[model samples]
Structures are given as structure tokens and as C-alpha cells.
Target: MRTLNNHKLKLGILDQSALMPGDTPTDAFRRTIELAKLGERWGYSRFWVSEHHDTPRLAGSSPEVLLGALGAHTSRIRIGSAGVLLPHYSPFKIAENFRVLEALYPGRIDLGIGRAPGGMPIASQALRYGRTKPSDEQLPDVLRDLGGFLADSLEPGHRFEGVRAAPFVETKPDIWLLGSSSFSAERASELGAAFSFAHFINGDGGHEAVKGYFDSYRPGPLGSEPRANVCVIAICADTDEEAERLALPVELALLLLEQGQFQRPFPTYEEALAYPYTEWDRMRIQVNRSRMLVGGPVSIREQMLNFAGDYGVEELIVVTFGADPAARLRSYELLAQTFELA
Candidate 1:
């Protein structure tokens, strides 16, 4: 059996600022900041926040804005978006946003962009409601424009060719393509951007998707070779039983979400325990369980490393959830301790 650590594997965190039970958005944001600060002190390599619009279940709608706060709290760890959904905004404008972030947190910024719409159809429509040209260009074109601006490699006579993203710093933010499929894998390789496979979203097919990325990578201005990571859901505790209990809420939450029954102010783990899941819900949880790694630190270590080995990647980005905020914080601490990350 492979120990799955021929070389040291780095770990990062993805915080969605999930709102639970009675917590306000302000409370959620504060917890997120606290997590970044603690994560840095615990030797985490990166701390990224996610974007979710018009969703009471998740308080973070703007990762770029949240990253600014994270930067203020942590001195060493890289802070970025788990990603910014680029489809709703302009490429040049998005470039400008990251440029400003890079200016503030210079060498510590990552521009992780995704092609997803980011929320429900109504919310997505609301976000782009006032756009004069909603379907101006495809995602690949927009990605190219953003990269061109970031690297100053715009082809001659291209639209917005000379329009620079200003306040440029000595080191620009690294661009990363976030997705869970081959489409993202190929595009990321073609553009020379770092790719982060969302194993938590799509557990299957990641091995092939990631293999395609590393096999067909074409180096560009962003990176000299392929750099890829996998993001997974984890809930670790002192005991396997405790970890499983802590993981209950997100399990139910995902099932409800997949079935179009998600509730606002997402249920806490304790509340979720009382939920009366039908047989179908139980079966769905069994399938969704494949996407999560829930156990004690030792068990979680093996599970995480297995996924890491499967994708042939060295870094794993973890997103943990629980009713107890303390357990959520401890989860990272335990993982770092088990891996001896320093």
C-alpha cells in the first residue's frame, strides 16, 4: 500500500463562510477571518474563500473583498478566491480587481477564477440583470483577455489591447482555473494556469481530468509547467464517531440542495440530527459520502492522501464544516499535526 506521501503534501483551506442556525452574516464573516488567521499560524499553505451570491446559507458573495480582510490578518499564508465566478463580470474589470488585491497583498494573492454561474438561476440573472451585453464573449475568450491583461501579452490590435490593469505590483497574482471536469483541465493547461479539481463537487473522473491536465500542459506566461491540486470536503475530530457526527449537517445540506429543498440559515449539525431523512435521502447521503472524508485525524489522513495519490497531486485544499466552530478550527490543527506540516 502506498503511504501516499513520497514527498511532502501541502494543505490549504477553502472557507465558504457558511451561516448556521442563529448566526448572522457578520458572525459568519468573523469566523472566516478567524479561520484564516489561525490557519496561517498552524502552518497552512493557503487560505481561500468562496463566492456565493444571494444565498443565506453562505455569507460570502465576494471572495476578492473577503481576501482583503484575510490578508490583513495573516502575514505569510497565501489568500485567494476558491474562486471568483468570472462569467458575471468583465474580464478587464476582473483583472483590475485582482491587480488592486495584488497591490495590497503583493506576493500573497491568487486569482482563482471559475466558469460557473455561482448561484441559483434567479440570483445569477439578478447579478447580470443590468449588463448591456450579457453574452458578449465565451468564457475561454474572457479567460484569455484576463490572462492577457495580467501578463501584458495582449495580441496587437486586440480589443482592449492597451488597456492595462493598473496599480501593478512587482509580483502579480497567480492565476488559477477552478473546475471539476476535463473542459477546465484542458483550458487550464492550454492557458498555463494552475488547475484545482473540485473533488468535493465531483469525486469521480478527477483522476482522468487531472491526468489530462498534466499530460497535455502547454506552458505559458503564468506557469512553466502544470500545477494542479484537488479540493475535498473533510470533517475531522478526536474520534471517528465524533467526526461522523460533526459531518451530518453538511451531508443533509447537500442532499437538500441537490433536491431543491435547501433551507436558508443552514441547519447546524445538532439540528440536522433531528431531520427525518427518507430512504432516498439516506441513499443519496451514501453516494455523497464518497465526496467527503469524515473520521479521526488518522483516518482522515489516509483518505486525503488516497485522493491526493489518485490525482497525482501533492497539495489538497480542504473545506470543513460543522455545528461547533471549535471543531471546525481544530480540524485543520489536527490535519497539520498529523502531516507534521511546518
Candidate 2:
């Protein structure tokens, strides 16, 4: 395993918004390209696209497709899914597609796997389409199968022995297991894969989950000690006031999600501030704010440095999707500046 030497903080971006309201897939693709370019220019080490289906606010439904598009545009920044819901796809197909991506991009591809359904129950059903009786256990099985496929093992002389992924690609992509819960920590540790905790979704101070991963870690082909990454929700602007205003969309989006408003694209920060919401909604937003950091570069930098120091994270990935594309890009730029890249 690589030793941690208090190296400079690593940065990455998570692009969740595809289009605001009326933007088509083409527009979203272009925006993705622009975001990737900005990420590379701003010193972001990687740019990960999330897998979301049937969500009007989210543009990345197929990470494999989006990754290909991103692969063509960016130069240095690595690209991959923040994760692909493994239970929804065949492990073989995933290995094949990502192998092709790895071959194309060489050293600049990441494979982050998540066990969640990645969509509403109805949408998930539609995605599976013909599959019946899909079990949660399928995720673990797929992860294991993927590891085998990537390791290029087929057992001795078995049928389909040493069958390489299509495109005849030969490269082992960096893999990470992503989750918002402890269930994933132990699983990733057991498999010796890098672990990424989604602090945005799972409340805060995931100390127990991180400890569980480290304590349970057993050296495997992929790693020796646990390689853990922390994912946080961050938004930075020139002023604290502007940052707070920009954060309104995220707060509203969370509130709406908690209240069963999934597919609706949230209003802008100014718009959200003007609209009327219930007291409960306001309270929920406040509670959610505790789990995120929203402010100017100085404040964001201080918070992130403190967070990284306290958590001992090897990598820090930020998910900064806003109601507007400009705000989203601005957030990335501000993060880069905070990291002294500007």
C-alpha cells in the first residue's frame, strides 16, 4: 500500500446536474465537457459523474456513456462514475466497458462502485426491465465477480477461461467502493479496495465507518492497508453572502427530496429564497446544512483542511452541483483557488 506522508490535499469534483430546466442531452453533454475542462484547468485531480436515472435534475444516467464523452474531452483529470450501481448491470459488461475506457485513457480512469439502487424504486424496476427478483445481495456478488474479471483469472482451463474483455483491452483500472453507510466500509476493507464515504448522504463524522474499514482491512491484491476517501458537499464563492445564497438550491433540493419531490429541478438560490416553504422544510434544510460546508474560499479552505486533518483522508472529493451551471463551475474554480491552484 502507498504510504500517506501528509501530501498536499487531493481534489476532485462530482457533476450531478445535467441540465437546469430546458437543456437537452446535447446541451448537457457539452456542459459536461466544459466542466471536465474546467476541472483539469483548476487542478482538480479527477472529475466523477454520478449515476442517476429518471431524475430531471441529474443528467448522468449512464456513466459508461458519459465517461466515453468525458474521455474524449479532458486531458489530465481522471473520469469515472462516482459510482455505477453495480446490482443493475452485469459485472462482465462493466469490466468490458471500463476496460475499453481504461485502454483508451490509459492511466486516467477510475471505477467507483456503489451498491445502491441508484434511482427510485419504480425507475429502478424500469431500468432492470426484464430482470425479476433482483436482490440486494446481487451487489456483493457483482463486485466479487468484477474483481475476478479485472484480475484476469478464469480458473484452470475452465470454459470462457482467460476470456478477455471486448476491445481486447488490457489494463486494471483503479477501483473504489462508494457508500453512505458502514456496510460498505467493511465490504471494501474485506475486498482490499479503496473506500469512499459519501458524507453528503450519510449525516456526519463517519468516524465509526472509517474505523470499521481500517480495522477490518486485510491485505489483498488490490491493497494492503485501507485507502479511504471522503466525499463532501462544498460550495464556494467570492463572498460568504454569495456562497450562502448559492447554497439555497442545494438546501431546497435536499428538502424537496426528503419530502418526496425527486424529479423536480430545484429553483435557483435567489428563487428558493423568494419562494415559500413550510417551517418543517426550513428546519430540514438547516439540519442538512450541518453536513455540508458553504462559504467563500477562505472559509471553505479552513473547513476542508480541518476536515482532512481530523479525518486523515487520503483523498478529498467534492460534489458541487448547483441549480445553475455557472455557479457549479464557479464552485470548482473557487475550490482550486482555495487549494492554491489559482
Candidate 3:
């Protein structure tokens, strides 16, 4: 296992393709593409995008489709899904989609799979076309099947054992189990797939979850060695106050999510900052903010390293997807500069 060093800590980006009031989905995607290019030039290790189906606030609906575009735009940085909602699609289809990407980019793709619907209940229904079974219940079996498809190692006599995910290439995308809970960590450990805990989504129990993963890791079809990272929401500015200011909108966004308004458009910077925070809202922000690393470059770098060290991982996929676009870009630039990634 590799020990994390602050000076050598690797950072990656997780973009949700969020949109403000005036921006169209196209504008958001273009920004995501440009962000990947900048991330590569800035020496970030991996650039991953998230999927949110038919959400007005976010544009990225299909990471595999988006990754194809991202793979063409950048050369050195690894491009990936943060991930794709695996339950809505077939493992064989996903295997073939990423196989096509691997054929194109050859060693620079990652396929992060999540069990969550990644959208509203109605949207999930539409996506499923009336499939009744719950995805969470079936995710483990799906993951195992996907591992076999990716490795061409389906057990003899099993259905689809000899079938190939077409356009097979020498390289394969890194398979990752992405989740915010111990269930995913345990599964990833059992299957030997890469694990990325969504710390931004669920802040508690992460250290325990990740520790369990490393301690109980076993070699499997997807990977022999344990690979892990934590995704964190961070906001960096020139000062602590500015960072807090930029975090307001995101805090409000999460608050809305908590209130069952998961897919509404993000509030504007002015709206969030100026909105009156009730006692409950303030308390929620306090809880949400505790998981975030928001400060200037120096403080952010220290907090990020401490986070990675606690999780026992060397890399942190940093998500600075604040409400401000220019500020978001500056956050990465400052982080790359502060960490000397470039």
C-alpha cells in the first residue's frame, strides 16, 4: 500500500456539468470539455464526469458518451465516468461501450459504476421502461457479470459465457465501484475492483469503510491489487471568507436535495448568498460544510492531504463544482499550483 504524502498527493476532478440560470445544457457540456483540457494541461491525474438523467441543473446524462468526447480532447490525463448508473443499462452493453472507448484511447479510460438511479423516481421509471426489480438488490450480481464480460472470464456453461463485448481491444477501462457507504467498500474489496467513496455525498463512516476495503481486499477478475480514492467537495479562494461565500450555493443545493428536490436548477450565487438561512438551514450547512474543504490554497491543500491520509489513499478526486464558473476553474488552477502537480 502507498502512503500519502502532502507534497506528492495526487488530485483528480469530478465534474457534474452543473448549469446556472442562463446556461444551456450545451454550454455546460462545453465547459466540462474545456475543464478536462485544462485539467490535463494542469497535470491532474484523472478527469471524471458524473451522470444525472434529464436534470435541468446538470447536463451529463451519459458518462460513456461524454467520455468518448473527453478522451478525444485530452491526451495524458485519464478520462472516466464518476460514474454511470449501471442499474439502468446492461453490463454487456456497458462493457461494449467502454471497449469502444478503450479501442479509441487505448489505456486512458475508467468505468465507474454506481447502483443508484442517478435521477428522480419518475426518471428512473422512464429509464427502466417498467422494469420492476430494484437496482440496488441486483447490483452485486450485475457487477460480477460485468467483471466477467470485461475479463472474458464468464464461468463455463453460464449464459453469455462465450459472447464477446464487441470491438475487443488489448486494453480495458478501470472498473470502479462508486458509493458512499460500507456496502460498496465491502463489495469492492470482495471483487477486487477499485473503490471510490463519495465523501461529498456521505461524510460519515468513510474511514471505517475504506479501512475495511484495504484490510480485506482480495484479488478478483477486475483487479488483483486494491485501488482506492475519495471524492470530496472543496471550494478554494484567496481567503476563507471568499471560499465560504462561494460555498453558499452548493450548500443550498444539497439542502434542496435533502428536502426531496434533487433535480432543481442550482441557485445563482447572489440568490444563495443573499437568501435568509433559517436555523434549520444553518444547521444543515454546518453539517454539510464539515465534510467540505473550503479555504484558500494553503489551507485546502493541508485539509485535502489530511483527508487522503485518514482514508489511507494517495489520491483524492477533488470536486470544486461551485456555483461560480470562473471560481471553479480558478480553484483547480490554484490547487494544481499549490500541489505542484504541473
Candidate 4:
């Protein structure tokens, strides 16, 4: 296994600020931008948003748009998707959007790719209309096509042969592979892309997957050495009780997802506090708590440092979820204090 080094832990924010129900896309975008601006002051290295279409709760369906907006507001913090689901969009289009952003931002953009559709079956179908659904078997080809577009490689006789992105961007946006399973680790390693492990997606068994990704990872085009980041659920507070209370928003969402009941992120912390759940919801909540890291600063730091020691993570992206935008922002502040991001 790899060991942690002295590279001042690269802290980042993974914003899904809309899950606080009734949160509008505009609100989510603004909140994320605010966080990015704050992160710049705190010395954070990056701020990543995700892409989820047709989801009432998630307003980050268009990550590129949000990233562009953030780039305009903040000068230093890195911005990108926790991942853009590659299976649903054309590689050329994805490259084009990112190319434009890179042109505007210079050295401040990243592009993380994931294989999941990131939404319901129907939503995925609608997004990929007329295009073949990508299977794990086809992931390599999809990645290759996207990679080719970025490198501006047009093989002879290919439909996009000799097609160069206009405006001639200066940056090759840093690309990261985001995944909840080991499947993507191999691909990231093979392609020399940085790998981001989603602990929030896989829950308690996340470290095993992270370890697997690093164990099998070999240097590729993104870097000669393997680079990996761990993304996890984190909500910090002055007191453990307060943190737990604030975590209710995410717990409510987990309960809903567990019961196959999906809704938009709530609008307020009080709104989530009123949600009704069954005994089964209680059971699932108990199970999911093991996957979350919520507590006071001391407790938060201890848990995270221990997890980092046990797993060789090169970067840590903290994700704060809740109904009230203020509460969500507080969670990030608390986490920043704990991680010394501030």
C-alpha cells in the first residue's frame, strides 16, 4: 500500500447543496460558488460539483455551466465535476465544453468522468436518446474516444478526423476518474487519470475499494505516479449533538433512497426535521451512520485522520449535505477548521 506524505493535504469541496429540499438550481449554483470563494481563502485546492439530470433534489445537472460560473468568480480554487457521466454525452461535446472553460480559466479547470448514468433509468434513457447505452465492456472505448478528442488526435478516415477544437485552448484540463467501485480504478490507472473514490456512494466498504484502486494502479498519462482522492460524507459542528442534528437532512435523503422513495433535496433544516419515516428507516439509518463522519471538530479530525492513515488517499474532498444553505455552509466551515483548510 502507498503511504501518506507531507504534501499539505489537498482539501476540496464536493457540493450537492440542492439536496436541502426545495433548493433551486440557481440557489445551488450560488451556494457552490460561495463555497468556492471561501475555499480559495481557506487554501483549498479544488471545488467539485456533480452532474445529475431529472433529479428534483440535485440542481447540479449541468456541472460545466456551474464550473464556468465559479471560474468567473474565483481566481485560485480549482473547479470541476466530481464527475461528468460520460456514457450519456458525446465525447466531442464534453471536450468542447471543457475546452471553452479551460480557455477562460487558464490553469483552473478539471474534468472528472464517471460511468454511471447518475440518474434514474428513464432519465438516463432520455439523456442518451438514440445512442447506445454504455456497458462496462464499452467503457474503455468511450474513454478512448473522449481521450482522443482532448488530445486532438484524429485518426485518418475517422468522422472527426482533423477536427480541432476552435479558439485553440491553452490547457489540457486535469481529468480524474470518479467511481464507487474498483472497476474504474483500473481504467483510471491504465489511462493515467487521477482516481477519486466516492465513499458517500459505496458506504462503509469504501476503503476496500479505494485500496483496490491504488493497489492495481500504475502510472499513466495523467501522471507518471498514481494520484487518488477520497470523497466522503462529512458534517462538522461545535458539538457532536449539533452535528448529528444537522446531519438529519442527509439521513432523511438516505432513508428516502433506501425505501426507493426519491425527492428533491429539502429546503430547510426544519423541513427535514419533520420528515416521517418507518421503523425500517430507523434500521437503515443505523446502518448508514457507519458510513458518515459527523461530530465536533476534534472528533471529526480524529476520525478523518485515522481513515486517511489507514488508506493512502492523496486528497480529501469533503461533501456537506443539508436542507438549509446556511447549515450546509456551517458544516463546511466546521470541516475546514477540523482539516486545517481554514
Put down candidate 3 lDDT per residue, 233-265, tens digits, no spaces. 988888878887888888888888888886567
lDDT of each candidate versus the true structure: 0.84, 0.79, 0.86, 0.77
Tens-digit lDDT string for candidate 2 (1-342): 233332377888877746777887778878888888888888887888889887776678889888988888887788988898877777779888888898889889889998787778888788777776346565555566787777676456645567766666566788889888887887788878888889888766476788788888886644456788888889899998989888888888777788788777666767787779888877888889866888898888877777766666757888875767877788888888778652
lDDT over C-alpha atoms for residue 96 of model 2: 89
Candidates 2 and 4 compared by TM-score, better number: 2
| Candidate rank order under lDDT | 3, 1, 2, 4
Tell me the TM-score of model 2: 0.91
| Clashing residue pairs for model 4 | 19-265, 20-265, 20-266, 20-323, 21-265, 21-266, 21-267, 57-264, 57-265, 192-220
Name the candidate, 3 or 4, with the larger TM-score value.
Answer: 3
Please rank every candidate by TM-score, starting with the best.
3, 1, 2, 4
- Looking at model 1, which ten-residue stretch has the lowest summed lDDT? 132-141
Off by over 4 Å in 4: 1-7, 19-23, 154-159, 221-223, 264-279
Highest-scoring model, lDDT = 3
Clashes counted in candidate 3 amount to: 0
Model 4: per-residue Cα lDDT over 217-244, one tens digit each: 7765454467788888888878999898
Which lDDT tens digits does candidate 1 get at residues 1-342?
235672378899999998867889999999999998888888888998999887777899999888888898888999999798887888788888898889888899988988787777888878778774334236667787888888777889997777788876566788889998888888889878999999889878888889899899998755667899999998888899988888888898788788876455566876788989899989999999988988897898888888787778889999987767888888888988878776
Highest-scoring model, TM-score: 3
Q: Model 3 clash pairs?
A: none
